[model samples]
Structure formats: C-alpha cells, structure tokens
Target: MKVKELMTKKVLVLKPNNTFEEAAKLFIENGIDGAPVVDKDGKLISIITKTDLMKAILNKWKMNERIETLGPKKVTTINGEMNLEDVLKYKVSRLPIIDKNNKIIGIITQTDLINNLVEKITKKYRDLKNTKLSLMELDSVIECSYDGIYITDGEGNTIKVNNAYERITGLKKEAVLGRNMRELELEGFISQSATLLVLKNGETTTIQQEFNTGVKVLVSSNPIFDKSGKIIMVVTNVRDVTQLYELKEQLQRNKEITRKYVSEIEEMRTQLLNTSEIVAEDHRTIEIIQLANRIAKVDTTILMLGETGAGKDQIAKHIHKVSKRSKKQFIKVNCGAIPTSLIESEFFGYEKGAFTGANKEGKIGLFELASGGTIFLDEVGELPMDMQVKLLRVLQEMEVVRIGGTKSIKIDVRVLAATNRDLEEMIKKKQFREDLYYRLNVVPLYIPPLRERKQDIFPLINFFLTQLNKKYNFNKVFASDALNCLYEYNWPGNVRELKNIVERVVIMSEDDKIKRLDLPKNIIGSNGMVVTLNTFEEGINLKETLDSIEGKLIKKAYDKYGNVRAAAKSLGIDPSTFVRKRQKYINNIDAQYKT
Candidate 1:
C-alpha cells in the first residue's frame, strides 16, 4: 500500500516570522508536535517542533535583552522525496513537502512519520505472510510440473530451484542458487532478446530452449520490486513444451520413412512454381502457374514442350510440388547441358574403370542419390541410345547395376519425363525408342508454347520487371510504347527471352515509366513484312493443303540447310519423311489430317 493512501489531508502551519510564543501556542492548540510556518502565499517557510517551541518558551525569546534573537529561529526542512531512511538520517521532528519549484508546500510532523512507519510495518508483515503462502503453493505445483522452476534475486542469481530444474540442467539446487542466469543457458537456452529486455527494462521474460536430452522447455521470470522501486527478486517459471515440438518433428520423420517404404527407387520430380522464385511474369504466364498447380496433384510424367524461355524447368518443379511427391526430393538434370559423352555414366552408375579420372571410391550416381525421392531429367531427349537402353533396363527391372559391380540393386521409384522435342515423330523415324515412348507417355502434359499463351506474355513481362525492380530495389515499370512494343513482337525465346529483354529495358530506359521513345528500336510502329507460316487465304482441297504445307516446310528446310540431305537431317525428316510423303501423295492423304 502507498503512504499517500493513508496520509492525512490537513496539516498545521505558522508564518515564518511568528514568535516562539505564537508557535508554541499554535502547536498546543493543534494538539500536534510540530507546526509548519508559511509565507503570505501559504507556502512552507519553516517548521516549529515541540522541542524547539519548548526551547523558545523557556528562554522567553529574551537573550541579553534581545527579544527576536533569544531562542533558535531557524528550522530544518525536508522534501517529500525523503523516504523513511532519509527521514531517520535527518533525525528531524518534521518532514517538509516541497513542490518541484523548490518551495516548501507543507511539513510532516515526527508523529506523522511514526504513523506511516507503523502502517508500513503492519503491511510488510502481511505481505511477507502472503509471499510465504504463494511460495508454498508454487512448491506444491513444481513437484509435478514437467518443467523446473527457479527463484532468483534481482541481480539474476538463482536462490532456489525445483527438482525438475535439477533433472533438466543436470545441476543441484546448491549449485544453481547464487549462480547468474548466463551460466544456466550456456547452450543458448535463453533467448538473447528476452535476456536483454529483462536486464534493461526489468520486465518479465519467457523463452524456449532445448535441453541436452533434446527436450524443449519454456523458461519465464518476472521481477519483484520494493517500495523504493528497486528490484528485490525474480521468480522463474519453467514448463516443458517438448512433447508438441517433438511430435511435429516425429511426423516429418515419419513422412520420410513412408516415402522410403513406398518407393524403393529414386524418382526425380520437378514441380516448380512460377512465383516460386525470383523472376518476372506476364498475365498468360501467371495463368500457366495456376494451371501448373492444378496439374501438380496428379502423379504423372508431364512433357513440358516450349521454347527456351517458356520456363519448362519451373513448370516441372511446379508439377512435382503439387503431386504427392512434394515432400520428397525434386532433383533436376539438364540433358541439354550435360556433356553427351558423360551422359550415360552420369545417369547410370559406372564400373570403377569405366572411364578415366572417375572417382576410385565408387561414386553414387544421381539416380542413387534420388533413391525413394525424385530426380529431374531435364532435357531428357538428349540421352543417346546406349544410356537409353540402361534407362530402359532401370524402368523394366526396377534395379541398378553399378559400373564394375555385378550386384543389381532393386529399387521402387516414379518417373516423370519432360522434353522440348517432338518425340512422336522421333519414334516414327526410329530416332527415339517406341518402348521408352510408351513408358514415359503414361500421362502426357504439354506446356503451351509462349506465343499461343498470349495472355501470359504481358503479365510475365511485368512479373520479370517487378522482379528486377525488387532485386535491384528499383521502382521500374514499362513505358506505354515499350509495353505495346513487347506485346506486338513475337517472343521466340518465350519467357526466358522476355526476362532478358525486360532487364535490358530497365537498364536502358531512363524514365520512372518507360516511354515510347525509350522502347527498343526493334518494334516502333513497325510493319516490317512478317513472313509467318500461319497465314492462309481460304481452305484449299485437303491434299492440296497437305502438299502446300509439305512443300513449304521442305523448301524452308532446304533453304536453311541448302540441300535435301542437310534439310532432311536438319528437319529430322529421315528417309521416313520422304517415304511418308511419297506414300501420302500416292494415297492422296491430306496434310491437315497428318498428325
């Protein structure tokens, strides 16, 4: 309880110049031991105590015939800031009440001070009893709590601790008490944020930690302050939160176990999200992302066919993430990127002497690393027939035979294949295997080429633009003309090409928003003749249309390669294309129905 809560509202007073006789009589009339002298403004001037009044009256204010200077006239003063200790130190009969302006407002008598002391003493006894009771209750609860408890002095030295603390910290009560908290959390059990706050602000703090046994626990403490606003002690509360935390960890572990048990082989699944990383996006591209999410849930081999910039890898990753294998490994292997000669060795394990400079300690292949997981074979069509045979064996036997090793390791795995090639035609021409085709064609998914997904072009551009902006912290946007230029042009490289273009645009364009003048010189109101293969006037006879398309394609192929052999080879139109054409012309087969 506060002293003010029990203090008297009224007090006695006398003018500073009042005679000793006047002070004595006022003190007597007030039935008090002291009287506060005040000025005309009712502000405190001096205090006349009983003893001082007695001295004054005894001398009769007459010393060598000097009435005003006979007895003690000066009075000792005290401010309200003085606590019980300060009052005791002064040994004064009265305590002065001073305003912040340094003028004494009133005085408190010795009797008033004694009255406050009596009340405080009474309250302290009650508080001590209450604290003892609370401690007993705490002790009772601590015996059974999963967490240990500790009581520390204001300086953060432990004074007491529960048995749980003994078990958790591996420290006895005798060892912990009087020990600083810093020593208790050597393993960083207590958070620095919490520690700093408690030290600086003397506020309560709680933190989570992992003990040596790996059990998680929460430690909390609050400061106890004295009437003088000094912290006297801190009581700490500890509770174990390990059960819940461990449960979550166990569930994740169980998932890994399930993945292993379900698939004895390694499967590489790449389910990439367009928004999954730092990049740009146009509207059509965003739609593709949403579509990819829709396809991810199904476990199937998705064939992503698109130009280089269409983000096929991203699409692949998106599919894997949406499928049940989202939690497993999503490894990526770029067939186009790997060396052709090393492709077989990389996909399937090699014998110790299979090749020069191979690791002496039989190295683990990607297929092995992706055991019970995923291994993305990006640009899969690049595999030569030799590796294709090995891959076929893996699919057929569900096992792997390491190079130089005779043992065949069986495995269960899912396969998701993707390529930018026209595999169907490759199969017809005997370039790609038919068996492999059937195996990989379990669920065929195609990423619509960029141009056809026109809706995604702008949004994809903007997405890339925004990516560049955030990455570089630049508030860059496209100019109206620049945007129109992008929309008007054909994106041959697709999203990848657009991103590079956007990066170039951001660096070259100067205004807050790119303007028409800032647009690349490539497409400025430009109507350069665009010779696309898509244009047509009307429907010709079916055979005529087929012949026309075949002739145009053959011519384009010839012009590009400068001869039939080179054109056929460049167009992958083996003897098959010529042979098929002969048969088609003979049979009068229409080109529109060619596929």
Candidate 2:
C-alpha cells in the first residue's frame, strides 16, 4: 500500500526560524512526537523531534539557533505515492511527505506506521480466512475426482490425501497423513514416491507408482513455489491405470486378429489388383502413375506424398514391381509401427549370441534381405534421430553392418519412402533430419486426395463392386439416388473408406439394388439435393441456363472438395473463376433467405 494511505494529515509544521522553546510548546499542544520544519516558501528544510527538543532544553541552547539545526540540516522526505516497502528502507521514525513543489504536505510518525501495519495484518488474516472457506467449499469436488490426489509440504511430509487416493491405493487417510513420503516408501505402503522426487529436484515428475497391494497408479507430481523461488508444496495426481493398460492389451489382441483377417482378404484381392493394371481413369491420376513408372525405371530414392488411404502404398508397390530389380525381394517396413528399442535390430540383423535371446545362427535384416531389390519405408517420419543417422549412413555407404558384427557388407538395394505427414514441417521442427529427407525426397510425387479426384470415385466404386460380387457371388447394384449421394459426399478417408462402404453396402443390402435409404446419413445429407436441369414452359434462356449450370458446377465442386483451389483443380478452372461463381450462388442463397 502507498504511504499516502497511512501518512497522518494535519501535520504540525515550524518555521525554519522558530526557536527550540516554540517547537517544544507546539509539540506539547499537538500531543505529537515530531513535526516538519519548513522555510517561508513552505519548502521542507529539516525535521525536529521530541528528543531534540528535550536535549536542547537541558543544554540551554541559544534562541538564535534555527529549528532546522536541532535535528538535521538535510532530512529525508518521501513522496505521497511511495509504497510502504520503500518507506521501511529509511531508518527514521518520522518522515515528511512532500509534493512536486518540495513543500511539506504531511508527516509519517511511529504511531502511524504501527497502525498501518496492524491494518495490513488484519486484512491478511481475512484473506486467509476467505481462502480456507473456498477450499472447504471445493472439498467435495476433490474427494469426488476420479483421479487420486495427495498434497505434501516442501519437507515431503504428507499434508492432505483425497478419498480417491485411499480408494485406489487401499490405504486409509490416517495411515498416510502426518507421514512423509520417504517413511511411506520404507514401510512398503507405496513402491515409489514421485512427491519425494519433486521435493528434491523442484521439477514436475510423472511416474508409475506400484503399491504393495499389487495396484499400479500413474502419478504426476508438481512442485508449487513461493515468491522466493523455494518449493512450498507438492501436488500429486494419481490415476489407477491398471484397467486402462488391460483395455489397451485387449485392443492390441483385437488388432492382431483384425490384421490377420485383413491379410487374408488382401492376399485374395491381390490376384485381381495387378500392379500394372491399377485403375487410373482421371487425368491427374494417370499423370501421377506415369511419373511413378518413369521413376521406377531407375534405382534412385523415391518419396510418395498423399493423405492417408489415398493409395500411397499402392503407388510404392507399383514402383517396386516395375523397377529393374523386380525379380529380387521386395520388403515393406512401417517405421511408425515398430518399437524404438527394436528398430535398429529390425533394420540391421544381429549376430548370433550378440545379446540375450539372440537367434542362434543370426537373422537377416530388411537391408540384407532386399539386397538386390527395393525396400519401402512407410511412415518414415516416425524414425528416431539415432536411427535416422544410421539409416542415412547406410544409404550413403551402400552397405549393412549387423548389431554385433564389425565388418560392413556391401549391398545394392533401392529405397522408397512414403508418409502422410508433412516432412518439410518435421524438418523445420528438427524432428526429421533435412539430409535424410533430401535423400529420400530425390523424386517426390504427390497423389491428390479422393475428393479432389471425384471423377475416379465411380470407377473405384465399380471396381470394388465387381471384386465383391465375384468373391461373394452376389450381383448388387446401387440406385440412382444412392449414387448421387455417393458422388456429392466428400471422401475424407479416401479410397479406403469408399471401398469399405461399398463392401458393407453390398453385404447389407437385401434387395438387388442399394437405395438412398441404405446409404449412411453422412452421404445422404452431404448436400441438400442433386442439382439437375429443369425444363421451362416456354423455352430455356441460353444465357441464364448456362449461368445456372456454371454456378451449380462450382457449388458442387466446392461442396465435394471444401475449398476453391481444390475445387478449381478438379474442374480444370482457375481458382478465381471458381471463387466468383461460388460467391454468386452464395449471394443468391443469402438473398432468398432474407426474403
């Protein structure tokens, strides 16, 4: 608080020429200990206190001596805006308050300072009381939280434990409270104490703490510090993730089962989806495949870019099958799917007895296995930094070195990388090496998303339909209305989502044809209605009809592609034209709405 709020007003002042006797009389009359001595212009000169007056009286000082001479020739005066902290730094009991004119405005005495301190202490007490009341109100929420909570002091002594903490750890609050984390750990109440770690290091820590009762909890401990940069408290949030881990394990098991089923189905479909005969009816798709074919003629690194489910894998496979090394082995590796710990051994084989549980006769790695062929690295952005360095070295040296072997074996293999992620962004973030990215991105090709290539959607749907019919011996067709919905709906998951939907419709439809009712709501509600030409009674206005057709095509493209640029690309029109036409239709809709 500012000193002005506590400084005493109506301050008694003495002229610089005032005698010691006059000062003493004024001090007694005002019942004050001190007063400011100022000159005729009302500017502060010095200060005289009761001690100075009494000392002068005993010594019988001369009357000619000015009151300013009694105490100090120069005195410290503070501005009204100065804070209490600044005031305390001065070692005097009485101080004069001054304004911009250097005139004495008021005085701060010892009694005033004491009173202000008492007021501050009372306010602090009230604030602390309010804080306690607020904490009491939120006690129920803390107890009801799904995650367990525990708080400890800087000394690692437990202060509070929530109900969830007791419930998850099977320990009573009484047993845990008043006992420090180290004590609890020694007693085997908790296998580990993250709170202790936070207290020691003063940093937030997350750890899995196991209890002697066989329950595992994920705990995150955060240290709260005071203004002095010292830890005052540690708050730990604990969650019983045993069930979560179990659920993840079950999901992995289900994923394995699904993988086996999909593998079998893909093996069967491989006979039909010949690498040389991939469906590429759209001009853009045909152009991309031709580029891939040219890149495949040689054995240089190739990078494929596209959205997930946009058939990046299909492009990689086509490149591998058409390359000069097509007669040799073709190995596909999903960099993201492998664990970081096992990725090195997976890429380069380990020698026999290299480490514990090593293969007796050693095993061949992907680089060794695909010595004379191509190895496709799918989702290559997930490679760790160390592995990226090793992979780059292998690429540059054209050889392989086993984990335990000292000698490098020379090899001849082509590398192809593909990722849905933006490797350029990853390179900027330092997550992916720029050198490795350049090596892999030697011949980069990007395949447009399914929505941008709507012309190819019907072809893909028909191909899946033919294959599904042949495999299941069913001749199912889609109705006109259903086909319209499928065309209007944007394929976010691209060809994979389209193929899955087609297969599901084929299997679920009881009738020979799939109707609008059989399609998913997303597809049916993608757009309000199919835009069709309406016949007029007299005749069609050529200009108006053409405008209407142009506007409808622009709107349809925008609806399917979700942007003017992609829509323009799909319709082979300029983005500006697409934007203008789309805006005209939007204005027409808005005007109709207002009316």
- In terms of TM-score, the best-performing candidate is 2
Q: Point out the worst 10-residue segment of candidate 1 by lDDT.
A: 59-68
Backbone collision count in every prediction? 38, 0
Off by over 4 Å in 1: 1-295, 351-354, 523-595
lDDT of 1 by residue, 402-467 (tens): 776788877655566777667777678666788887877766666666677776667677777777
* Cα distance off (Å), candidate 2, residue 554: 34
Alpha carbon deviation, residue 548, candidate 1 (Å): 33
Candidate 2 residues lying further than 4 Å off, grouped into runs, are 1-277, 526-595
Question: Candidate 2, residues 492-565: lDDT per residue as tens digits?
Answer: 76877787778777877889899988875556774433334563445546665566677678767765754445
Angstrom error of the Cα, residue 583, model 1: value is 39
TM, every model = 0.41, 0.43
Error at 53, model 2, angstroms: 99
Each prediction's whole-model lDDT (CA): 0.57, 0.71
Model 1 error, position 454 (Å):
2.0
lDDT of 2 at 346: 91
